[model samples]
Target chain A: MGGSFTVNHLIYLLQGMMWTVVLSALAFALGGVAGFGVMLMRTARTRLLRQISFVYVQLIQGTPLLIVLFVVYFGLGVVGIELPPLLAAGVSLMVYSSAFLGEIWRGCVEAVPRTQWEASECLALTRWQTLVDVILPQAARIATPPTVGFLVQVMKSTSLASVVGFVELTRAAQVVNNSLFTPFLVFGIAGVLYFALCYPLSRWSRSLERKLNVGRRQAA
Target chain B: MKYNFDFASLQEYWPEFLRGALMTLEMTVIACVFGLVIGVLCAIGRRGKRKWLATLCGAYVEIVRNTPYLIQIFFIFFGLASAGLKLPIFAAAVLTMVFNVGAYTAEIVRAGMDTIHPGQIEAAEALGLSTPQIYWDVILRPSLERVYPSLSGQFVLMMLSSSVTSQISAEELTGVANSVQSESFRSFETFIVVAVLYFGMAMMLKFAFHLFGQAIFPRRRRLGTPL
Candidate 1:
């Protein structure tokens, strides 16, 4: 072994934690944009677009995220394009998250009462206006809790980026353990750091779900 | 930028791929069976009158829920080896998956159990059914039937997540893909094939679960709803 675990190792782990957060944020933002398009296609009037989007979601959802990361990382190189690890990781995560978020938002949109759509159309609002002004506002409320819950999943998944040699929290812990030979200590601390990052979001999502249900119950 | 794909080079490795897929299925089956048992027990513990047991179960669920499976696997595989208790990679992978999925299964089972009305349990008691009888027939069976969809979804996710075990060189589908890619130098094509294999496996698993659910839950088949 190189040496025992030290204060410097802790600092390295903390830095890695920051990268994990950054990667999650990047994935969420990119995925959110792509997922919105996917949701629109899924809910759109065009049967072909809906079918295509459905296949895309099914393909992504059925395969493991690790495989997606490998495909992105190596597929780019196969075309003689050398991208950095962070970009590859971010792209794969974006692809993975979009499928899930698309499905989630689709459910939220469908949850909006059909009468609202009819009323919007009855008022001479165009389809885009009906969706933008009326349906989406209602769907957004139903979508918040599950979206936040999925964020916790996104945060935990960033750990897998380490497989592609992205030196995030899990990779940092592995590096520390390689030198220190203290698997329990190093990974234990890393788990605690992940818990710290994810627990608050999980709790917040649960509270949001509860509050949403209570609101629904009162309305009923 | 002329990169012609060469999947012909990978054709010879189809046997290896099949073996890896078989191992993946084996591991998933073992983990699902044991994980469901652990989950049900923990759910019962969580619902029991003992405060410490409930707290311990809750903590187990939260800790596993919050941490990544990759970290959990690393912790289990390397940590056990360090303690001089070396295990085969397959065994370690299964153990890690059992621990990880057990927590999630417990949460799902607990939620299902919560939907069982309290008056039903009282009716069971009035019928003079024993504790185990009440649990098995009245409480557990219906709860499982209700949450069967969620449980199947988790199991399918567990099968996909098994890809993470490849990190420790477990020789599963992903592990086989890594080796094949390195040897053939066709990384993209190798992973593409593996991705399709995974997609097939996921669909197969879903169909199998649906059939199994239909077989086990007669109430669902007869009434067109879970009881």
Candidate 2:
């Protein structure tokens, strides 16, 4: 309690920030793949596939992310499966991000004009071929900003991993604050670090939207 | 590889979960009311002619938007205590939520305001409407109506996030589940029940908002148009 805020605490926070980025990267990579599968199922030709994916999305979205974390961490601990905090946090975030990313990408894919699908169909291309060649390429442009924005969200959410004993940025701050007894300084610095990470992405998303929208406006 | 599940052990704690859910609902309702009041003022300020006022509002919105809600809660609940401005757990949770949702609501309402044609404001002024009258009738009402769906959706999201307040032991739904799980040793079962309750609450709020919207915006309801 007598220790003052020092360079050591800052170094610890930076390391925690590093883990936040790592966890966010891991979640985004895994979630992106699973989200792609979800998007495909959502837009699938079969009604059952669409319905199943729709309910999955709804279930995940309707619940709190924190509860999802709890279920993965403490809830699963009841079973024989023992997960490290890092793995538990990563998996829950993956599940959370996948549902959201799937929905966002689905919207982008559907935004691709109906005529593009028909045009590809007229060319005697297979459905998979049309999707890979024509649909996804176009959808990628619209998805870029939101996907980047979601990256920020993923990073911010990694803070909650601290609850599961993961030593990410927020958790690190809490640890430092506990020892130093300076909650305002510790958390304020943590907030600044978060801003440094996220503000760029937010600005980038905004500018990308403007740039993309401007091009379409000029074309029209 | 087999584990026995016992949800029945938690039946005695029904009152705890019920109280927690009610507490969450009460916090959300308070947050909604105060958040909208703050949000409207901030939105109007940001778009107004006063440069400093607009900048201040913009900064508030951006800072809250950029940070994690968990840290914000910690800062408000624990951080402020160090500065000797101690608040009750309930007050701190509700305050942080109001601060959090106000920023989001400001952006949404601002977007709605941007969509209103300028001619409508001028026409309202010409009809002998005073400044407050013009804003209430021609600006805020329509903007709020237009953004009602997004506003309600944000509010529902707020309801779910109220679970985070349980960390400070506000004894909301998640907090109740935490206590019950430790007591009953049925962690998975406790959270399973809690998640379903959250889902139900979300649906209920959405339905309530829809009815409220219909009552308020009869024009949209009668026209069969989406907001």
TM-score of the A-chain for all models: 0.99, 0.98
Chain B TM-score for the candidates in order = 0.96, 0.95
Task: Quote each prediction's TM-score.
Answer: 0.98, 0.96
Q: What is the lDDT of every predicted structure here?
A: 0.96, 0.91
Residue A175's lDDT in candidate 2 = 91
lDDT of 1 by residue, A1-220 (tens): 7878889999999999999999999999999999999999999999999999999999999999999999999999889889899999999999999999999999999999999999998999999999999999999999999999999999999999999899999999999999889899999999999999999999999999999999999999
| lDDT at residue A103 of model 2 (Cα atoms) | 97
Top candidate on lDDT is 1
Which parts of model 2 have CA positions greater than 4 angstroms off?
B125-128, B221-227
* Per-residue accuracy of model 2 over A114-143 as CA lDDT, tens digit each: 999999999999999999999999999999
**Number of the top-ranking candidate, with DockQ as the measure:** 1
Over B1-227, each residue of candidate 1 has an lDDT whose tens digit, in order, gives: 99898899999999999999999999999999999999999999999999999999999999999999999999999999999999999999999999999999999999989888899999999999999999999999988998899999999999999999999999999999999988999899999999999999999999999999989986673322434
Which sections of candidate 1 miss by over 4 Å?
B221-227
